[model samples]
Target: MSREFEIAREFEVDATPEQVWDAFTTGTGGWLWPMDAPEPREGGTGPFGSTVVTWDPPHRYTNRVANVEGIAEQTLNQLDYTIEPREGGRHAWVRYVHSGIFVEDWDNQYDGADKHTDFYLHTMREYLTHFAPRPVAFTTLDGPEASKAADALSTAVRGLGLAEDVPAGTTVEVRGPDKGLFPAVVDYHNPYFLGLRSDDALIRVFGRNHWGAPVGISVHDFAPGADAKADAAAWQRWLDEVFA
Candidate 1:
């Protein structure tokens, strides 16, 4: 069935409004996955292939994509960001909206997008707080077929010494790719999403079993030695062992 949804969220980040503006226009890699640089003016193309609808530096930027492929019923996909400086410009308040018209696999597409948005935004705050301006090495990998099991996500979290009920802002220990163990904070958690942020990275474990798919993880590594392919392979090995 066709569905329309708007996800509106407001959060404070430990960054200036200018830094927040760069996060959307140029520095997305510091928070979200990297993308081609978008043109800076209205009528220019955005990094995600959307047309820039509005562009006002450090304040408002909106983009829209029309007639998405493979989704014949889709009409529009738009993203809007509004930033306001606060606390003497030491921090910023961000308002984000993702509104779209498309087909919905309510169990997966709609809900997954909603929850993943929270995790990504949480990562944005984490990045601005601890690792801003450092380019991150981001990589994503899918787990083995066994990861499709209902308990798959819970299993991995337990392996990290965390319960699904762990509250955010709590500190915990998690195994690193090379180091024996490293510290991370529970940045965000929900039934379908788990986010952990360490001194130099953000780790997101997605529970996609509900979508009839394998579980997956995305790492945003900002350490000086970060390498995307190498890091992804290392995590792939860990995921395989977790579900084996």
Candidate 2:
């Protein structure tokens, strides 16, 4: 017996249920992958040939993906999200499951989607905690070496002799090619993703395997009165140097 490709992840966010719901439904601007979603009316057209399956505020929502713009024929991918309030509604727990079938190369497709799940969730947490309603400029750059292995990217990110993973409590100086040493904390870490929360930025490295494996670097800056374009360029230059 065989099973279709499916991925599920749970997240504990330090925000109210309402906040979390808004983050997922709004649009890419709200922390989800970059895509456009209309008002989310049932039976109405949605982004990428999707239909709103369920829309219960502050609780659960579902979307059925029939046609992903570029991808070939497939029955459908069900995207379901369930949110539960924790600690008397002070914080929330999020569960996201993306279930679908792949006709071929399941490993590569699953691997890419699994890692991306982490990246997007972390972005959501960052948005609810730091960036929020004040808009974020998300930029991503991919390279051949970056996507090959998670360990390799981890080694590069642990620059300046930092450990393979940042120390638990010790404040260590981490340096990037473009931006020298900056005070940052290792917010989340797993084999597929590394998230660093700096004073004014949220930096992440994703180990993804699209049809071809490629490493992805993303930066979300929340500096006061910041320039999105300039920030994106700086991060791109840094990626070049790191992967060079």
Candidate 3:
């Protein structure tokens, strides 16, 4: 059995539809939403085209989005916005319609649609609510021992761009996977951090701060066979330059 599903969410942005439309159609605004690299153009790039399908100025704009990767092959997505006049500005209701079919099993398609809708609504709400500048944090660590490693990592993090007054008592030790060679362990603030590793090299970086204000971390592992010492020195210099 094959199944299909449809989902829709609505929001009221403080800006006018024209303003909202610009944001929706422009690359800067696209970053605020879910699109990775949105290029608004009709029969061009991005979810929406170049010109507005229903350009009612401060009232509404409806557009069709077809040029997606995986979803484009099986689905048709249309976004419609209806803006109503309000006290100080306009109230915008965004309706996203996704109509598609499943050539295989309908149950999975239905469940997937449900999940996708939930994610879509959540993403939209997050963008609208937090339309402000946020900070991005990166962290790294180095050391001869585990404890020293943690301290070195802390130094790297502070050196990068994070506040020096990052919360204390938020560090923990983590072990690397077994692959023959020196055992590797790390001090970390959160598990979501990224880690990179190679013979004679280890680096960790915290990507971005979540809404919860927790620091993300990543570790890099590297150890050269023949040029181990030189490789390690080069890695340290790279970190220094990046954090500096």
Candidate 4:
């Protein structure tokens, strides 16, 4: 079965289309778009490929992205912007058209398309609105230290009996199933965790599971370098009360 869906949303940004175009075209600002490496040029290879189909200053800019994962082996994702002169300035209308069959499965394709559209629009908004240069890092846990941490966290999760307490709060705005479903007791390898962010810290609570049963506990900690002990204790108490 073949299925297709389209998502279109508009945002009233504080910046003009010219400014928006520049930010998107510039290498430094392109990260907001989640492009691997965006090199804006009429026909120069970059995230999408070589060739700028349309580059009408401020008002419109269009490019084609080839080989987008799961989509067309050579697909064209076009972005068009229109600026309408308003009371204060120009109101921008950004339209994205993705044409390619990246996936054979209709469900997967629709889901991927939905996420891509959302991310694209969100990145645009972030750039034009709350542009923050936050530090992000990635690290893998391995060896003995990693094992110890995992064990401790696992133990804590088991002790908490988390399955009983429903996780309630604002969903993690990040994309993915893990973000949408929280406080759910899942399988051992796919346990549920809660993510929290504050002005001072970002916290991740790792849940534990036995077979497919959830033990209502999680090992909580502030982002790397911050104290975990306090956060862990706090999470423990919270879980205790929640389960109680």
lDDT of each: 0.83, 0.70, 0.40, 0.41
Better of 2 and 4 by TM-score: 2
In lDDT terms, how accurate is model 2?
A: 0.70
Misplaced by over 4 Å in model 2 are 1-3, 28-30, 72-75, 144-151, 158-161, 167-170, 177-179, 209-212
- Candidate 4: count of backbone clashes, pairs at least 3 residues apart or interchain: 10
Which lDDT tens digits does candidate 4 get at residues 109-169? 5554565455445545543543333332211111122223334434433433432232444
| lDDT value, candidate 4, whole model | 0.41
Which 10-residue window of candidate 3 scores lowest in summed lDDT?
Answer: 132-141
Q: In model 4, where do residues sit more than 4 Å from their true spots?
A: 1-7, 29-41, 69-76, 83-85, 132-244
Top lDDT hit: 1
Location of the lowest summed lDDT over 10 successive residues in candidate 2:
152-161
Full-model lDDT, candidate 3:
0.40
Tens-digit lDDT track for model 1 on 214-239?
A: 99899988889899999899888888
Error of 4 at 160 (Å): 16
For residues 121-183, write the lDDT of model 2, one tens digit per residue. Answer: 777887798767766666666754654654556655654346775643446576864667777
Q: How does candidate 4 fare on TM-score?
A: 0.46
User: Candidate 2 — number of clashing residue pairs?
Assistant: 3
Q: Give the TM-score of candidate 3.
A: 0.40
For model 3, residues 1-244, the per-residue Cα lDDT tens digits are 3344465555565555555555554433222222333333333344433223565554655565444346533444555656565546554555555454444555645555554454434433433333312221112334322212334445544444344444423332322222113332232233223332222333344322321222322222222233434434554554545334
